[model samples]
Target: MIRTLDGKEEGFPSPLIQIRRQQSHLENWLENHKFPRIPCQSFVVISSPSTIIKAPKSLKSQILHSANIPYKLGVLEKKFKEQLLTKPTLKKLSKTLMEKHTEEDVDLFAKYNISKNDILTGVQCPGCGQFPAKRTQGFWRCSFCKHKAKDAHLRTLEEYKYLFGNKISNQQLRSFLHISSRTSATKFFSTLNYVHEGRTKDRVYFIP
Candidate 1:
């Protein structure tokens, strides 16, 4: 006899034990009813809906019926034969399916207004100022007028700011500009004729 938490004698066979036994029996029945064979990689052509399949000689009608795979051996063979006959049609169908899938992908991208360039580059060159300088065989040219400067200028200015703490000396400016000679550097500096509120050596040039 089993006793419940409420202090009552349940029965010789408790409700919990009976339920477990029933569950086990049901599981065994289901396992026995399941099909023994796995499905093959064969695909049926949709062109002929009345096609059939033929099972192997080893699998009898009684066994097939027990497995619940509803098909006679003759019907299975007929279906396979029909599939072979419709090979050309299947190829055309496959090609059309691929084309339709590709078209759908393209349409989805277009709907989102996403650009290929955006995918490649994090930011698109806005073509602002002289950015994305026109490319020549050996150098990049300005997209604007014929105003051309050596590629070195862009890098030099940045270096000048770093070296001189932004209060660039005349000599330092020349070095930044990459002038070949000190004389040429001085000449360029004189052209600016910048005058600051200090002595000559301490004077800073300001762009006019």
Candidate 2:
């Protein structure tokens, strides 16, 4: 019989199976997408430790800084151990953690809902829609209005890299894109390849 971390039959085929299903879904979503923010948001909501642990080293640090959460490899390991109980059960523990994180993400999003129409005139590019177009090997262009603008979404990714590298959090990107929503930022970033890291948020820009 399948048992929960508490060692009780929770009545599902198997908690491990459930965790595997959830993880597979998450992995597929991330693989199909380019920008990290959306997946990061989902990861946060799910409280997936893998999201935190497997994140690019650059992004992880940024996430910690953006969330104002303390970071120590040992701390994460301890938390994972306490929640997971055993190495063999790490998958289930990670799923549980992701679920909790997802809850927190929903709460945070509700708290800070910004309308994109207010910032970009509600007019998206026709060719690329909200996402910019690839202009060159490291440059992106906005099809709408035919503006030769760099990727605006990459700015947040760079910020995460600068602050936490792979540890960057969705919260940080949301806050950075004050004029837009988290979803918008994620879509926008997916179009760009690089960004200019800066000290001030306003100065950040997607560099193709």
Candidate 3:
């Protein structure tokens, strides 16, 4: 399912050619894997119910709103129930697909013309929803709420790694996590068993 913020619609998501090309790519991949060819269906959902969607009749995808999903899903269940793969084959296929999968790195900050340095440091305090909570000695304390946490830095690191990059430097972690003291930052680094490479400032840490 797909949705657009503006109640605007083009022929097949973007243009006429891309849908067929993408479907062909999927079919080729399935053929290479010796799997059954599946039908490609498309759906575009829009928030504004008042706005009409002028979809092309040639396309296989449907354009609908959230209100129509339940009925559409009911109809789709029949197709899903028609095919049944053996338990072992299904498990093996799923495992193999997972093992061979590659992740695409996306840099949202750069795409949106935002600077990483401008981002607020430290974990957002859950109690007060305030940013860059002070990294006091042995605690992450929110100045406004007077709330303190020990493991708040962990959540901040997870966001940093997700939105920025999979790997982080000691300096990056310290700056982003709002740790002023190098000794404390090093101490925090010691707590994690992340895989490391390079020497001194050249070093990077990533989940093994």
Candidate 4:
């Protein structure tokens, strides 16, 4: 149920080209994605009364405007109700889709003009807010407050993943966490439950 908020719909076709593109994308994705057998339909919805939208003769019946939506969807609901899957199958299918939904290789550093220099280095003590929380003997030692938190590094890693990509490699974890040792980076990743892949140097981890 998507409706364009723009008031000027003067010259556009009923189910606009934009609407058709969306429909095509959904149809193609449904037919080609991992679960290609999932059933779905696309509709163009507009609610304005004065908007002169004229679908080509072939597609007029497919467009849904305010006046005919209830009757059309009511009829559709009765037909689709019988096709609902069992709970277990539906849940497993949803879980698979969610696990595979992570977008790969999105470089936020380039997208929003961010760089290593822009991020504030050092972990602030979770106990007492203070910068330059150095990694000392496998613990984040905040010199200002003399507070040590074993999990402070995890907070920084979480933030880095949030701002960048959901997936991370040893190199990315090292560079983002500002750790020099590969063993130290491995220690950080050990605490997370990730779908691991590849051999030693080429391994990547992503939450599923």
- What is candidate 1's TM-score against the reference? 0.22
For model 1, how does the per-residue alpha-carbon lDDT over 1-208 read when each residue is reduced to its tens digit? Answer: 3335577656454333455576666555434644222223222222333323343554333222222334544566665563332567556645754664542123433667865344321111223334334324323355554444435243434434433334656666654443445566556567556443446666566433
Output the number of the lDDT-best candidate. Answer: 3
Range of the 10 consecutive residues with the lowest summed lDDT in candidate 3: 8-17
**187, model 1: CA deviation in Å?**
2.6
Put down candidate 4 lDDT per residue, 179-201, tens digits, no spaces: 78899878877876678889998
Give the better candidate number (2 or 4) by lDDT. 4
lDDT of 4 at 65: 74
Quick one: best TM-score, which candidate?
A: 3
Instruction: Order the numbered candidates by TM-score, best leading.
Output: 3, 4, 1, 2
TM-score: the better of candidates 1 and 4: 4
lDDT of each: 0.44, 0.43, 0.74, 0.72
- What is the TM-score of candidate 2? 0.20
Residue-level lDDT tens digits of model 2 in 6-118:
66555435333455577677766554543232222212222434333334565443233223333444555565553313455545546655764642123322346754333
My TM-score estimates for the predictions, one after another, are 0.22, 0.20, 0.67, 0.43
Q: Give the C-alpha miss distance for residue 105 in model 2, angstroms.
A: 7.2
Q: Which segments of model 2 are wrong by more than 4 Å?
A: 1-84, 103-117, 122-208
Candidate 4 regions off by >4 Å?
1-113
